[model samples]
Target: MTEVTEAGVSKAGVDEAKAAMREIFPETPLQMNEHLSRRYGADIWLKREDLSPVRSYKIRGAFNFFRKAIAAGAKDRTFVCASAGNHAQGFAFVCRHFEVPGVVFMPVTTPQQKIDKTRMFGGKFITIRLIGDIFDQCYAAARKHVEETGGMMVPPFDDRDIIEGQATVAAEIVDQLPEGVIPDLVILPVGGGGLSSGTTGYLKDVVAPENFIFTEPEGAPSLKKSLLAGEPITLAKLDNFVDGAAVARIGDLNFAALKTFSADQVMLMPENAICVTITEMLNVEGVVLEPAGALSITVLEALGREKLAGKTVVCVVSGGNFDFERLPDVKERAMRYAGVKKYFILRLPQRPGALRDFLNLLGPDDDIARFEYLKKSARNFGSILIGIETANPENFAGLVERFETAGLGYEDITENEILANLVI
Candidate 1:
C-alpha cells in the first residue's frame, strides 16, 4: 500500500470541497478571541467549526463522502453508518440535504438528546436503528447491514474523501487570516485524526505553522500511542467521558497524513482535568464547550508560560454538542481538579458530640458537601462518608492536619473510584 503524506493532501481536493460545501452551508466563522488572547498573552483565534450545521466539523466530511461516492456512480442509493454522536448527526443532515435514503445505527445506550437531534436533522430522509449497548456492536451491525443490503458504509473518520473534506477547514483558516497573519502554533484535538490530519496536511502545504500540538484525552490517547509504536494500536479499554474524542484507535487513513509529526508533538491530557477547562470556559468566558472541545485549552497549563507568550496561536474548539444533563458530573470533576472539594471516609466515634467534634475540626472556610453514615461496625465507632468543599485549596491541607491531630480515623476517597462511585 502506498503511503499518503501531508504533501499528498492535494489543494484540488480542498477546492472541490469548497465548491461542494457551498451547496450545504457556508464556511464557518474564524474569529479572533479577545478573552483567550489576554489570558494566554497571545493573539488567539478560534476557527469556529463548532458553529457548523451539526454543531461540529463532522458534517463536512460526511457530506463530502456521500457526494464523491454518488459521483463515482455508486449505484446503491442507500447509505449506512454507525455513530451515536456527532457523526450520526452529520450523516443525517447530509442525507436529508441530498435526498438520499440513510440508515444510521446507534448504540442503545446513546442519549436521547443525540438521537432527537439526528432525527431532527434527517427528518424524512433517514431511519435510525438502536442496535447495541456499545459502539463496536453498533458498528458491526451497520457493516452487516451494508453487506446484506448493498448500501455504502460511511465510516466516521477513516476515509480519503473524509480527510479531503475536513481539510477544507484548514483552507478556510488560511483564507480567513488577516494579511501577513501566520500562526506560530496550531493546537488540535485528535480523536481518529480526520480533522487534525486534514488541517495539518493542508496547512503544511500552504502555510505550515512553526509548531503543531495535538492533544487527546489521557483516557483515549490513540494518536500518542500510535505515534510511539509506529503503528495504530487499539486500546484495551476507553473512558467514554470524552466521548467525542475517546476513540480506541486512530484511523489508518488519518494516521497516514499525521505519521510525519513526531510523537513529542502530541500531548495527553487527563479526562477530569479537561472538565476544569470546560467549566471555566462556560462560567468565565460564557463559551459552553463539550469535553472534546476543551482539549486544546486544557493543555495550555502544561505547555509552560514562555512557549505560549507573545505568539499567535490557533486552538481548534472542535465541537459544542454538549448535553446539559451531564453538568453535575462536569462540575464535580472540575471541583475535584481545582482542589476545591474532597471526599473522605471517616470512622467517627458513636458517642454524643462526636459529629460536633468532627465539624469543629474543619476550618471556617470548609463546608460539608456530603455526609452519610455507612453503618455502626462497633458500639464505639461508625463509618461515615464525608465530603468537604473549601473556599481555598490550601484549607484542605490544614483541615487534614487537624483531623490527624484529633486522632480521627479517616480515608480520603476522593481519588478512589471503587469507593467513591459506591459511597460518594
Candidate 2:
C-alpha cells in the first residue's frame, strides 16, 4: 500500500474550504447533545450536518468542486451528476448558487418527495433526468451525457475537492470545542468513505482521538473489507436499506486516507438497529435523521455502557434527506429490532380444530399482526403465514415452546430474506 503522508485535506483545507464555500452556504453546527450525553455516560456532541442549507454536508464538497472547476477556466461549462438523494440535492443547490447550468440524473424509483425537493432547490438552474431503476444505471447515463456534451462531471464523493470540502466539517467540530478540549472518541458514518475519510484525515494530525469508530451498514462494509484485503473491493450485492451509506466500493482516493485504520475500528450496524436510532431521535430529540444520519448513534449499543461511561465523544449526524413514505418500512424494522415482531410459516392439518389450537397458544400480550392462508392441500394439509407482534420479544420464545409441545410443524420466517421478499 502506498503511504500518502496526508497531503490530503486537513484543518488547513477546512479554512480553504470555508473561504470557497462561503459563497454557497455557511458552516453547519457542531452542538452539544445533552440527551445522548446523559444516556451514554459521555460528554456527547453532534455535528449537525443535517442542518445545512441542503440538510446535508454534500453542499460543501459540491461547492468546492464547482469553485475549483470554475477557477480553472471552466466557467462556461455545464455540470452533470447522478445521485438519488442528498448528493444530487447539494449539487443542484450549488449549481443554482453559481448560476451554472447543470443536469442531475436520478434513478426512476426515487421518491417523489426527493424529486420535488431537488427541483425546488435547483429552480431553473438544473434539469432532472430520470433514467434507470438502479443507481449504477443512472450513473452510467450521466457519465455518457457528460462525455457527449463536453460538460464537467461532479462525482458524489470520490473527487479530491469533495474530500477537502467535507474536511471542513472537522474544522467546525474543533472550533466548537472549548480550548484544550478534545473528544476522546469520534464516530463517523462511512458510505463511499468521503465524509469519514475527509474528517479522519483532518483530525489525524491535530488530535489522536483515543478511539475512532466507523459505522457502516452491515449490508455495505466496503471500507472494512478494503482495509482487510489491502485494496478496494466491490460488493456483489448491496442492501439499500441504509441507502445513504450503502456503497458497493469505497472510493480509491477516499480509501487512501482511510486504510490506515484497523478493521476493528469499523463497526457494521444492522439496518434494523439503525431504524431504532432514527425513531428515537425523531421522537425523543425531535430531530429528524435519515438512516445514514443515525449511523453513529445506532452503534452506541456495541460500545457497551462500560467503555462509553464518562468520556467525551462526538457523533456526526450525516444528513436528513429522509422520505416520509419510507416511514412504514422504518417502523417495521424498528419493531423487529426492538424484538416486538416475528413472522412464521405454520403447517396446519385440515382438521376443524387446528385453527383454534394455534390461537390458544398465543399469550395475552401477543397480537396477530398478519395472518393469511398461503397454501392448501386437497384433503389433509395447509400452509399459513402468520406475523405476531407482542409487548416484548421474549413472548415469541414462549409461543415457540407451546407450538413445539403441541407437535405442530412450523418454520420461523422472520429472518428469511427470500421468503420475506416474496410476501413481507
Candidate 3:
C-alpha cells in the first residue's frame, strides 16, 4: 500500500486529473446559494456536484482510476465494481465514455430507479449483475469475479487513485472562488470518507485545517468513530436511511488522509434532520437532494446562525438522485423532526359517539393523517393508532390538554422508536 503523507494528497496530480476530466464533462457549478445565504445570514455557496453527469462527484474518482489504469498500459480491458448507488452509476458512465467493457455488481434490494439509471449510463459498455441482498454480499461477488477473470477492480473509496480523483472537487472550489476571497468554512458530507478526505486534503493546504467541517449521518458515524478511536472501526449496526452516506466502515485510504483532523470538526446529522433539508431544498429552491447530499446543508442548523453569521461557507451537495416516490416519507420525517407531526396510541372507549368526541378535541389546524383501531372487537375499549399533523407544534399541547380534560387515555409514541416502528 502506498503511504499517505502528513502533507496530504498531491495538488498538482489533482489539477492534472481535473484537466483530463474536462475532455469528458465540464466542471460542476459552484454557485452562491441565495436561499441558504438569506436563511443562515452567511455567504453560503454550494458546490453543485449534484449537477454532474452521473449526478454526483463519484464520477471524478471512477473516471480518474480508469483513466490512470489505462494510461499505465494495463492489459485487462475489463473492470468490475460493486455499488448500489452513485458509485455504480458513475463507474458505468465512465466505462461507456472510455469504451471499455465493465461489470457492475449491485444488491438485489436496490431500487428499480437506481438500477435503471445505472444501466442507462453504462449502455453497451457495461453489464449489470443483480447479486446478493446487501452491499457486502454484492461486493464479495464482484471481488470473486475480478479474481477469477483477472479483471481490474475499481474500489469505491479505498484506493489512493480514487482519493486523488475526488480531490479535483477541492481544486475546482479554489479556482471557482473570486480572487482574494477565501471561504471561512468548507462543509463536506462523508460516506466512506472519500469526498471528505480528498476535499480536506487539498483545502487544508490552502485554507486552515480548522476551516473544514465534516458532516456524517448520525446513524453512520464511520469517520467520527475512527477519529475517536485513533484508527478505523467498523460499526455493528447502521441505519441506511441516508443510503449514499451511510457507510459502516470508513475506507482505510480515505481514513488515513483524514485521521489528522480532530473529532470536534465532524458533525453527526440526524437522518430526520437531513430529510428536513431535502424537503426544504426541493420545495423552495426546486433542488432535489438524496439524504446524503443534504448532510452538509443540514448541519448548518446544528451550527446555528450565531456561529455562521457573516461567514463565507461552501457546502458540497454530493448527489441529487432522489426517488420522488419517497417524497411523502421524507416530508413525514421532516415534519416529525420539526415537531409539527406525531404518532400516538389512543385508548378509546368502544362506545357510540366515542369517535365524534375525540374529533372535537383536535384544534382547527390539527388534522388526523392516520387512524386505525388495533382491536376493533374489543368489548370495553380498543387501541387506536393515530398520526396527527398540525400547523404549529404547540397545537399538540393544547390538543393533549383537551384529551386529558375528556379523560381519554393515550400514549405518545412519537419518540418511541421501537413502538413507532412496530405500530406506526
Query: lDDT of all predictions, in order shown?
Result: 0.88, 0.88, 0.91
Quote the positional error of residue 127 for candidate 2 in Å: 1.1
RMSD of each: 2.1, 2.6, 1.9
Ranking by TM-score: 3, 1, 2
Better of 2 and 3 by TM-score: 3
Q: Candidate 3's residue-wise lDDT over 1-424, tens digit each? A: 5434343567778889999999999999999999889888999999999999988999999999999999997635699999999999999999999899999999999999999999999999999999999999999999999989989999998887888889899999999999989999999999988888888878765779888899999899989999999999999999999999999999988888888899999999999999999999989999989999999999888998999999999999999999999999899899999999999899999889999999988889999999987985367989899999999998988998898999999999999999898987
lDDT of 1 by residue, 265-317 (tens): 99999888999988988988788788998898888767855778898888888
lDDT of 3: 0.91
User: Which clashing pairs does model 3 show?
Assistant: none
lDDT of 2 by residue, 1-424 (tens): 4322252654665677777777666678778888888888788888999999999889888988988899898989999999999999999998888899999999999998899999999999999999999999999999999989999999989888898888888878887888888888899999998888788877876667337889999999899989899999999889898989999999999888877789889999999999998888989999999999999988777787688898888899999888888888899999988989988988999998989988999999999999999988556989999989999888888999999999999999888889887987
- Among these predicted structures, which one has the highest TM-score? 3
TM-score for predicted model 3 compared with the true structure: 0.97
